[model samples]
Target: MRAPRPRAILAVLGVLLLTACGTAGATDGAERATEERVVRVAAAADLKFALEEVADLVAEEHPDVRLDLTYGSSGTFVQQITNGAPFDLYLSADRGYAEQLVDAGLAAPEDLFSYAVGRLVLWTPDGSALDPAPGLTVLAPEDAGTVAIANPEHAPYGRAAVAALRAAGLEEQVRPRLVLGENVAQAAEFVRSGNAQAGVVALSLVLADPLRGHGRWVEVPVDSYPRLDQGGVVLSGAADLGAARAVREVLLGAGGTEVLERYGFSLPGS
Candidate 1:
């Protein structure tokens, strides 16, 4: 081919550079479009079933947002968040814990909202000879073996279990037979796995599918323990505040309220 003039070659080079830049920009835009919005949630173990359902509903509406949930004792989560854990939101079984975050300036006071009221249940695996009904008096039987409860020091459900036992005057009799789980969910597991003959767990957990028909439960009288006013708050250090708030709404809105109710949770103020 004949050599091109200097101007012609310069013009071609400029076009090539512009095309490369355009292609690069398009690629960057595509990458940004596909980037997922992640919301890290620190939730109480009692909320495992209900929150998972809420997450599914949230996904249906906000596919770009991914909810990353960490379930554990509410007290433990409070400690973690206070120490600057990168969680985007906190859902506590005890409302007080979420309030504590606000007091510490880790979360906005206005962002805190009560989501549900948890109830305690006395649960025993199916086919168990023990009858949890009538009351905690069943624990007095000689063959009761062990009763599993979450660690009262950190798990809100555990505290309620203790309170119920005390109210029923069974604390002394059941004290020696107690086996502590790290959280309420683990306490339910202890009973399911036959490690403990019976347990006191969140009513929401008992109403969940796998456990709902797998065992027998008696609702502990509400008067037996302090009400479990569950609360949630958006964290101050959230990577995406809007996304975090969106997830929070999913738990507090109609869809979440229905799911929570289906799982045996009573809505706050209901």
Candidate 2:
């Protein structure tokens, strides 16, 4: 072959250089695009705000893991989980529900993690004539308009609300005007929307952003109802058990504890 012309050689070299640079850039981009694994979670409605904050903390530490949460009543969740729902984690409002899963063979006992002890609150809209200062007895009047509470059949908070009402000797009066929500959050919404004059809901819900400044709340006496020690479990069928375990540790870690405490949940030791 004849000796290549100088300009042609330089052009060939330039094309090769450009091709190499493009390849390097592509490789770098691929390396930076880390894949995140999704963990499906079924959490109690009482954990709506706190769990969201905990999930944010989980994201910060484990960029490779992501949580997709579904919130509802713990009892209902227990039934769903028993029926083989595809949730990676089940965070219940009552730890007993988690234990039930363990007993039912749906979850291993070692996988259960206690998250927090939940509190119930009596909430009233800001300008409403009703005041929760009088405690559960505030709903005793026949003309108290309407009272909202979670259904005791499924929601832990609902059972607590009913207990508190009964303890206060107001069950008869309150039950007559009670509006049962599917979950504690929904009961708070009933109060927020003015559908009910008063609500018996999770302290966390009333303390969360949406209801924080718009309503007034009084904590229900802890002795009136069973202690709502909340807990969760990594499902036996979790797609990413490692990720599920990592998320569990995040909840037990300081950041998650702070978020839970800030939302009115009591720590196990505290």
Candidate 3:
């Protein structure tokens, strides 16, 4: 076979080198690509802005990790999680849902913990003629054509809103004027859009920049309603428990606490 030509030998060597280089480059690329692990989070609508801020901070330290948050009413989130929603973490605005998940064998109680103490508030758009004093009486019929609140059946914040009104002895006077929102954030929206004279919403919702620029708020007396203890847990089917745990830590960590505090949330027991 003429012992193979010299050119053929060179060609074979070139192919081998190119193949080795390509493999090396591919390996390097893979290593550099963000090892982002998707951690699906079922969060309360009230937590929309606060959680996003925490997620951004987490991304700074964990460029390879990303939080996929599904924001809605706490009860709705609980139902979805029970139905096997693709979530690695659950952050409810109230403890009831998290406790329910634990009791239902859907979440591991050992992994569950309170993340924040949800706060409620009365919010109104700029220049609105509403006074949000503690234990304030309901406005006259003509003064409050509508007062917004989330649907109590599915939103923890909504329940809190009702509780506050009841505590203030305004429920009977205000119930007929109540405008139901799908979530606390939506209740805030009802005020922001001038659809309601005033609204009860999560303090975080009104504290968030978007709403802050459009309105003013006053903290509802903490004593008026049951404590809103928000909690979270790692899902049973998490593909990356480590990532989920990291996110949980970030939410419970000092940095996370600061972020929450900045947005009107308080640390558990604080």
Candidate 4:
């Protein structure tokens, strides 16, 4: 084989350079794809079930984005967010909390939007003699034992339970017997674990797979308490603002609404 001519040698070198550049580009692209894109969300306890489904929707829609969800009372989360907890999104069981964040400048008003209206329920695990179908009246009996509710101090569902009890004229009688949980999910757990005879919990919890069909529950009359009016907001310090906004969209989108509805959440305006 002979040495290549000058023009031919230059052409070969150009092709080699192009190939190397293409390989480098492909490697960079692959590296970019492998880097995990995450969005951290602080959500209300009542969303324990429905939000997980919404997360599935997020996964299907944005394969590169991963959601890290933490569930608790909206009030507790409000305090956490206020104290500078690093979260990309905040989903509150009460829209008022989201509004509170907007007012405080922790989240933008434009980034805040209502998602769903939650419902409260009277729940009793399987084999309980208590008939919750009669509504809040079941708690009237002296033998009603300990009734669990989320702590009204910070939990919206707990506040709603208080309101419902008052509306049913049972506040005075049931107040002394109430067992308060840190959040609504814990309230349900109190009943499920047999620590409490009955509970006033988020309807979505009873409808979730883990508890569904394993117990019985009756809707606490919507009129009996203030509407839940759940909401979500993209935080101002979101690590990935774009991903946070995408999450907000997924929760309010048709697919997310469908999941919320299936889990017994009422949509806003519809």
Backbone clash count, each prediction separately: 0, 0, 1, 0
Using TM-score as the yardstick, the better of models 3 and 4 is 4
lDDT tens per residue, model 2, 156-262: 99999898888888888778899999999899889999999999899999888888889788999999988988988988889989999999999999998999999
- Write one digit per residue (lDDT tens) for candidate 4, span 1-270: 988799998999999999999999999999997886799999999888888888899999989889999999899999999999999999999989999999999988899999999999999988788989999999998898889999999999999999999999999999999999999999999999999999999989999989999778999999999988998899999999998999889888899989999999889985
Q: Which lDDT values do the candidates have, in the order given?
A: 0.92, 0.90, 0.85, 0.92
Q: TM-score: which candidate is best?
A: 1
TM-score of each: 0.94, 0.88, 0.89, 0.89
Q: Candidate 2: what lDDT? A: 0.90
lDDT of 4 at 269: 85
TM value for model 4:
0.89
> How many residue-pair clashes does candidate 3 contain?
1
Predicted candidate 3, C-alpha RMSD: 3.0
Residues 1-270, candidate 3: write the lDDT tens digits.
569999999999999999999999999999877567999988889888988889998898787899988888889988887888888888888877888988898778787888889888887777776766632464545566688999999998899889988988788888888999988888888888899988888888887888876766678899999999888878777888899999998888888999999998888888
Relative to the true structure, candidate 2 reaches a TM of: 0.88
Q: Which pairs of residues have clashing backbones in candidate 4?
A: none
Instruction: State which candidate, 1 or 2, has the greater lDDT.
Output: 1
Give me the runs in candidate 3 sitting further than 4 Å from their true place. Answer: 1-33, 140-142
Span of 10 residues, lowest total lDDT, candidate 1: 133-142
Q: How high is the lDDT of residue 93 in model 2?
A: 89
Ranking by TM-score: 1, 4, 3, 2
